[model samples]
Target: MTILQPFSKLLKTIEPLWKIHFEPRVPAEELAKSRTAGSIPSFGFFFLLTLASIIATLGLITNSSAVIIGAMIVAPLMNPILSLSFATATGNWALFLRSGLTIVLGSFLAMGVAFLVTVLSPWDVVGSELLSRTRPTMLDLGIAIAAGAAGAFSLTRMSIASSIAGVAIAVALVPPLCVVGIGLAGGSAMTGVFGNFYVTNLDVAGGASLLFLANLIGITISACLVFVLQSYGSLRKALKSLALGLLVALMLSRPLGTSLHEFAVDNRVQLELHGLHRDGRFRDVNLIHRVDTKLVNGVAYVNIFGAANEEFIEDQKNIDNLDQRIFNAIQPMGVHTMHIAIRIAPIEIFEYRNTSSSYSYQP
Candidate 1:
């Protein structure tokens, strides 16, 4: 049999527990009607979608987590996505078309609204919120899968309907669309900006799009799995659709894997720097204000910014001595080549006495 046969057998063995935790709470007819009702397109749905997109775009531009969460709570896109998976699981062609169109059109509408906002807004800086969406790893995929499963499970139990808000926040549908809008609108203007750091909006948009697609596919497939397990749909059809979703997720894993590696490298670089600071006599020197790492031509470059005693700044020999130590600290990491640039700010120390105050300087 297939590699999954053993797992399937295991699931069958725990069928009773699965029913208690995940079985459908509503009748099949009621669930089908609910999905159909949610799939129907209307002006109200589009209006809410547009509003949520605008709010989410603003939130991302301003780096406001609260505003972004608010947008997530208001987003109507989740229903259509769930319905699409449900339709596929049930082999309902009409419902599938209805939900699919809702998702496609709604996504475009959200992106269009975000684009218009970006074109008109004076803010040119890409904030942390926007940048976070541009990088998706396997961790993000896992979150989406878990969120999707939780979302599907929540829907079946009316007592847990309130938990959908948490799912919305976890999956984060609108913000990525907003990032796409910002990327599309910024175009060439996105280069060499404060937050952008010479990365083009097109590149940012592509990454964000991949993230959004991963979330979409992950949610759809996971929800399909839940529906099948709950016995709400055609098991054969659900398995087929689940296979397609898994294939798409597999394709996405390549990039996500690369991103994960990059993330690990960055973390390792930071950890190495932290260890150096802790072990060395560099306690008087603050190297943690800002640290930037960039890789070019197979060599890693690090830029550290912090303040030091003014005396340290004035003595070129002493500064050179410290620089050598910094280099030595990073050498053990096994990087073939690395360049470290240090930016030191002078600090003035003031001593207050009974009569007069004395000042000392260090960099």
Candidate 2:
């Protein structure tokens, strides 16, 4: 028996409940026709896509989440993607080709529009919104899968079709592609936040493109599965496409896994820093200006910039003890070797008494 035999049997056991609870309100044939029609690249589709791309690009540049969400609502790209998934599931070659072409053209159109906008605009800085899409992890793949399933399910039930907007926001098809355009347009280099884990010269275009590809592949595979499960298509017919999609997702998992590891390490470093502060080791430090951690050649380097009181600055032994504590704290997290540097500047505090009209240095 195949490895899926047990799961298949379990699904069979619940077949009645599945059908009763999840039957599509729309007929499969009608739904397929609707999706196929929507996939056609009409003038209206391109016009709306262009507007969404412009809005999304501006949002990324300005770091406005609300504007990006507005673009997501306006974007028509999701229809073609869903059509592609349905076509793949049903083994409809003509619909597949049409939807695939629409997707490709729409992608390039959005990218081109974004490129032109970024080139013309004076704002060239890569902001938090743009940087967030650059390094996608497996969690992003999970979100795409869930969103794809939700999107397909909502389409089958007209009452809940409005949820498609939320699904579009969740998967984010256009913004990352717009980021790809901005990156290609030679936006300023991104550093400081995401720079510690990656090299100074990170490939902004490549990373955002990978994110878009991940979302695309993830949605296609998952939406196809949902269609098959809803009895809209035959599993045997969809198997080949599903296998190919899985293979691509597998290939993508490598880099995504590495990014996830880096994210985890960064979180751990922050947690350790907070732990030190709570444990009183950082009591003398007034504020932590920045913390940067880099892993290179099997060694980890940590740099901390902070402002501290004069007592911490004057006492060499205290600084040495704190350094040893930080090193010890991070060593247990699987680092081969570690180098730490803490730069601190002295800070002074002042207090004034209104009644006495006098000011005193509180140190």
Candidate 3:
């Protein structure tokens, strides 16, 4: 009934049209052969991934990009995330659950192992990599959704996996969890990132974890659609599978669902901002950029960047009362407390003298 259903139907027609030529969705058996190869996690690889996750956590806590990247390479998590999509496509519930549990349990394993190392180790600082995970917003959701699609598509085509692996890292599951444990270990203010504030470790951890889930969910959606198209199953079966999978995906994305609601509201806020900007009461200014939405205590804390500072300020003395100006801009939104990352340059002061009819000037 919806536009999307019809569009999906139209795409399905292409499969029937081309079904004569394409190879049957590679038999599920061939794929499983590789499973046994990785069955007994060699002590070396196990310790390597475990050790790497720990070092990466340490790197994140120290805000070290280089260190964190090293951890990503050593991370064996990507295989499971991809395997999750693979198993979902084939309707192999065993593999699906196996991969899913591998990811979930592996994540816990990585975090626990990393925490033990951090707890015992000497360094005791929480860095930016740790700080970055403390918020979940539209942006983080978007990244995961996009990456999920990419991962599924790449799997379908079997092309360029290293790049896809990098993207898996970018969704960045391991690092943020490491950061969360570090925050707990340090007993830092968890408000913004995780507990209640904008950039708390919880915020970042929840957001990043949600992002990972979104990627997995997104990949599954794409995989399901592809399976349906490829005669992965009959229409009735596909629909049932899709419905069931979507239901589960939705549950995994509770934080993402809230963000979507906030984002819809944020969109309306943008529509109103145009009128605010056009009125020129904002001082003939133009916007530079703005973070249209953010999360704080599970609500939106949106910001818009505009070019004019004077629109919000009248004189040098006004700088002293900047809080009032910020309050006035945000008061209408019922924002209890908001932070403005505004940029301004002080106006140069000069006294002028008019000397003649032609008005020769001096300062």
lDDT by residue for model 3 (1-363), tens: 787998898889997888877544444454444432232244554576687778887787567888888887777666666565555555667766776666676767776776687788776544456655654555665676666666544544433535666665666766766765555554544432211114323344445455555555565566456544655444564455567767977686676666665565555555555655566544333453333466575344655444444534455453344434544544455456655444342233446887665745798
Evaluate all candidate structures by whole-model CA lDDT and list the values in order. 0.80, 0.84, 0.57
User: What is the RMSD of candidate 1?
Assistant: 7.1
Q: Rank by lDDT, descending?
A: 2, 1, 3
TM-scores, one per candidate: 0.78, 0.81, 0.60
Question: Which candidate wins on lDDT?
Answer: 2
**lDDT (Cα, tens digit) per residue for candidate 2, span 175-266:** 99999998888644543343222223546898799899999998998898988898888889888888999999999998887667656666
Report model 2's TM-score to 2 decimal places.
0.81
* lDDT of the structure predicted as candidate 3: 0.57
* Over 4 Å off, model 1: 1-24, 191-202, 284-363
Which of 1 and 3 is the better model by lDDT? 1
| Model 1 agreement with the true structure over 11-110: per-residue lDDT tens digits | 9999978777764497788889989988988898999999999999999888899999999999999998989888988999799999999999998998
